[model samples]
Target: MAVLKPLGDAEMDERQRRMMDAMLVRGRDYNVFRTMLHHPAAMEAFLGWGSYILSDQNTLSVALRELAILRTGALRRCEYEFLRHAVIARQHGFTDEVLHAIAVGDRTPLTDEMAMVMKAVDELVVEGRIAPDTFERIRSTFGDHTAIDIVWTVGQYSQVCMFLLTAGVEPDPDVADDPLRPLFA
Candidate 1:
């Protein structure tokens, strides 16, 4: 179980209550919000912008986006994020083999475009800067705006992983074998 109790749809403060209602009507709950509820204002601001990024406009294909997500999740060893995005990656056409490669942090199976994305993420996590080659490759492949979004997406999820770990949030049950779970266990 999560160290913090998840706020139920009917069991939130008025502001949160409204947000929860909106989320439920969309047939989902923001697990991130449930954890971020301790700071309601931050939660609202984060989710407001986050929803826009994830839903309002994204140019990358779902497969590419989710691959980037999974790669960053694994790099951070964030179980909750990794597990949730694993299924998303699958839904977006990543096979078990590809997901497994990401889980184990292998970059060999990735296509040129995917390799460029993973290389960018690896450089950021390991060195805090994108290498020149990877940057140019990403720029050539995705252009400036999409490249910026991809970096922000990875950074956002990196922050999410940090939050979930520090908050001691439980893994989403739907994905039982998140690669990070073994570390926590």
Candidate 2:
């Protein structure tokens, strides 16, 4: 069971009720939201902003965005984020082969643009700084605004991973790992 009890259907206020409805429609009975119910305002703003990014963001398609998100999750070893995004990744056209490769930080077959973005993510996460080469490559490929969006997107998901892990959020039960080892390991 989750350390924090979920907000039961009967317990939610109107705002939470709407968020819960959206979560259910997205097939996410999220343990994070359950825990965050302790601070409903934070949960409301956080989830609302998150929905906007996933649904209304510019600069990247759903597939590319989810790829960056899953990569950040895997790098952080945040099981909740990884598992949730792994499912969404597939829905957004990440083939099993590509998914497995990404789990291990292999960005093979990525477009030049994606590879540069992934390289920036890898450098930022692992080395605490984007390498000069990665910076140049991405800047050249994507221009200023797009490059900023890619980096910020990775940073945003990284923060989500940190929150989910530290807050003791549980992974969705419906998804399963294939080749990658369990993240919590």
Candidate 3:
């Protein structure tokens, strides 16, 4: 059960309902977003930044960004976060084998860039900063724009994953059929 339960439509204030309805219209009424609506002000403020990080505006490729997100969730042992992004990663064309490999640090199936970025995610999530050498490697390979986005993606998603894990936010029942569920650690 969730320590801070997600609100149903009826439980929301006018402001929260507006926010949630916007997502519902977009087919993104996920449980974490619902749980976040408990603080409409905070969630509203978070939306723009969240949008940027997930939007076309982000310099990193969707596939690679999802990889870092999966890695962050994995390092935190956050099932909700990892599993949700696993589905998103698949939609972006990553295979189940690749998703599992990213989540569990099995880099053999990943590209050099994918493996390197996942290692950077580990540094940010577990040690609170990316190492200088790794940052240089990222910058050299992907350029400054992407290198910075990787850090922000890992840093932001790590915080969000911590919230989901600590709040004990249950996955939406619909998530049960996701292929990643079987491989969740």
Candidate 4:
């Protein structure tokens, strides 16, 4: 069960209702936001930084950003986070082959440069810093700004993953597909 249950419409105060109405995920209030509405001020603060990483301001292509997010979520074993990003990734043209590779540690599904990027996310998650060689390669390819964006992207999603897992947030109904894993149970 969720540590803090997501508030239903009736449970929300006017302020939370307004926040919920404004903070749509996939066009509806996701459980993450519903749960987060318990502290609207904090959620509002999270939104600004989250929006930047997710917006065009970050300078990483949507595809590259999603790649970093998917890796961080998977490495963290954050089912909620990984599944949601899986939806975004597919919407942006990530193949099932690539998604499965991320879920299961297979690199064959990615391009060489893309695989290197994922490796950086993996190191960042597991080691808290990308190794010097990986850092140099990414800096050379993506430039200083984008290289930092990759770190920021991973950091953002990883924090979200921790929140989801720690709070025991459930997956939204709209984000239920999981070609990234499993078949008939």
- TM-score of every candidate: 0.88, 0.83, 0.95, 0.93
Order of all candidates by lDDT, from best down to worst? 3, 4, 1, 2
Clashing pairs for model 3 are none
List the candidates ranked by TM-score, beginning with the highest.
3, 4, 1, 2
The models' CA-based lDDT, in order, is: 0.75, 0.73, 0.86, 0.85
**Winner by lDDT between candidate 4 and candidate 2:** 4
lDDT of 1 by residue, 1-185 (tens): 57777677556788878767777787666576666776788988888767755863866667777877888888887778777887777677787778878878777888878877887888877787788878887889899877877777787778788888878787655557654457435
Candidate 4 residue runs with Cα over 4 Å from true position: 181-185
Spell out the clash pairs found in candidate 4.
none
Among the numbered candidates, top TM-score falls to 3
Model 4 TM-score is 0.93
lDDT of 3: 0.86
lDDT of 3 at 1: 64
lDDT of 3 by residue, 1-185 (tens): 68988889899989989999899999987999999998888888888788899988889998889998888888888889888887788788899889878877898999898889888888888788889999999999999999999988987887798789878898787776777766654
Candidate 1 whole-model C-alpha lDDT, 0 to 1? 0.75
Write down the worst ten-residue block by lDDT for model 2.
175-184
